[model samples]
Target chain A: MDKPIRVLVAKPGLDGHDRGAKVIARAFRDAGMEVIYTGLRQTPEQIVETAIQEDVEVVAMSILSGAHNHLFPIVVNMLRERGADDVLVVGGGVIPDDDIPVLKEAGVAEIFTPGTPTTKAIEFIKQNVKRK
Target chain B: MNLQERLAAGDVRALARLLTYAENDYPEAEEVIKNLYGRTGRAYVIGITGPPGAGKSTLTDKLAKALRARDNTVGIIAVDPTSPFTGGAILGDRIRMQELFTDPGVFIRSMGTRGHLGGLSKATQAAVRLMDIFGKDYIFIETVGVGQSEVDIVKTADSVVMVMVPGLGDDIQAIKAGIMEIGDIFAINKADLDGADRTKIEIEMMLDLNENKAWRPPVCKVVAVENSGMDILLGHIQEHRTFLSESGELVKRRARNIRNELMDLVRDRVMEFITRETGKKLTVDDLVQRIVAKDMDIYSAAQYIMEAINK
Candidate 1:
């Protein structure tokens, strides 16, 4: 049987508001994906470690603490260092449109703003998540 | 030459990979566990849980260090809260234990609750089993302080330590019910604070009200930041272990835990199978519509769904 896609949803930095992250987690669960949520105030190293330990197909980071530029790339680099560069990296939460391109260039597959529907994110994962 | 043998020999990379395979319910995980299962049951499993800011992480670090000093290898599974919005974990538990990373004798992994209603991750028990097989002398499972669910998950441990701090305001009321009854040891952390004595007394009072069992839980005072009272706490942990073994409840409890784990795994697998078989043909919305339109009652609808799979 084909395995369920495993996704790690991480909240990077000092962001304390986790209601949104919880909602997305449920959405992914309902979509029949296995999700591991690392709770609030995670550093990039912690996120990478969890993603590796969980063997997730995707690492979706939600940062609302305005540290996305610092946190996101650090996570990508760490995952690469850990030989998990094949895992799809995505970001969400209040990212400016102009910054999205820069984040994408740094190895983030896509960035979702607040209003983007859960289905769209799910669909993106379905299409982009590479199976080993 | 199986994965379990490799794990038992202290192969960190293999252990990490095997744990992931197990977490995903991969078929090979069963083979690995089957090979390693008999090698387990040697380690002492300790569960440390409390509310956030109770200094659970700091206490865990201190405890790990103490264990390391005794030349006992330690395995830690820290259950961090998951971001509900993104289905991710902000795994900050490791921040306090960074110094142990290079210590070959200590292996620490942070796991997210992963939307499990229980405070601990669903994969936690399995991970503990893996650690036990890896020949750790002590394994500590820490929860993110959400209350009852945390207590339930920790019930699988051989000993449970509920950490509390002074000035938490409702410390007494919080420990009055549910998980409170399950604690084998209570630590009033931050014992240097003004209300530390009061918190200790409250726990003592609670214990006094309860009838004495063969093993009475002890309350210790500790300042985790300063690493004081750690020796006494370790003595209490050893005392608890001796209590469990002397009472012969350890084997019985482990048997029950194994039974519960087996049932949970079966239920999860069966549910996944049924969902996959039926979900392809019918949406959850379709089932809802059928029930709402009175075409079928909820039970009959469920029966019909089950019948569809059998057919």
Candidate 2:
């Protein structure tokens, strides 16, 4: 059988509101994607660490604590430093439209804002996942 | 370096990648396992299982902690149920095991029992083998011990520890036939809770009813959160390991496990070949169409497929 797309749904940097992350995780699962959710309040380092350990093809971060600007880039840079730049990074949860291009420049493939449909994110992952 | 060389050099990323390959049953997984097969057979595999809410995760955390304290490098595989519809799983075992997260000595992975044709057990064993090859001294396989599916635990672990808690009436009755029979060591967790003694007595009584058994499983009472009775439980595991080795049961059990693995792998290969062949010509849909139209009976279709397989 074909290997399912492995996606790590992480809530980084003290984001206690995990309802969005949980929802997305479930959505990904329902879409037949293998998701590894590392619960709430994870660090960028821990998130990257888990992403690598899981050998996930995508790292989807749901940040509501407004630390996405700081945490997301650290995760992206960390992945690059670890020779894992090929792993796709995406973000969701309260990310501003103004910051979308910035995050994209920082290596985030896409961002699903608060009103975006979960299917959009799922499709994004399926389309953007870097399968080796 | 290649995966083998990196793994031999103690690279964590290499280990993780190998484990992923094994868990997904990727084609490269077989090659990886074959390459590392000679380096395996070193880690002591212990399977921890019990019904849901029996504190299996908490107990696994404590056990991994104890093993780490003794300077043993540990690998943990916590298996949770996957959604049959989505093929996705929310593996929350790691939430209870946060302490081991940052510890370099411990490598923890949570797997979903995707029910992909008995794939959970096979993936788990493969993960265990990868961890073993990576040089972990102890490997723990934690499963949601509900039904007969948990029999896979026995086939994988050198010693199987069944965790239970008191005050849940019919808990033993629910799992008695399958899980109860396979436990090498029984743990009544939450010993501080009421009926702990009664639960212990129940298991002891159950054991007493059995006859002609060379080794009897011991019941250990533990308050997992307090970390009490863990050392004793570890001691029992060590004792069981020693007994298995001394009695030559280790060799026998491992031989049986390998035989089962070989058979399962052959079955998987056969299925893969058939699927590939059917994809190219004579799709399963075509067979169904024939059966529906009464052009081919199901039994005859099976014979035809077998014949095709042979050809």
Highest lDDT scorer: 2
Docking outcome class, model 1: incorrect
Name the runs in model 2 displaced over 4 angstroms. Answer: B117-119, B171-176, B276-285, B292-295, B309-311
Q: Per-residue alpha-carbon lDDT of model 2 for B96-211, expressed as tens digits?
A: 77767778898888787877433244588788888888899999999864654457788888999988889766545734566678789999999999899988888888887778
Instruction: Single out the weakest 10-residue window by summed lDDT for candidate 2 chain B.
Output: B113-122
lDDT of 1 at B27: 70
- Model 1, A50-115: lDDT tens digits are 676556789989989788988899999998987778899999998899899899999999999999
Candidate 1 per-residue lDDT over residues B101-124, each given as its tens digit: 557788777676666766688778
Return the TM-score for candidate 2, rounded to 2 decimals.
0.92
Provide TM-scores for the models. Answer: 0.72, 0.92
Candidate 1 runs further than 4 Å off: A1-132, B1-5, B170-175, B277-285, B302-311
Compared with the true structure, model 1 gives a TM-score of 0.72
True contacts kept of each: 0.10, 0.56
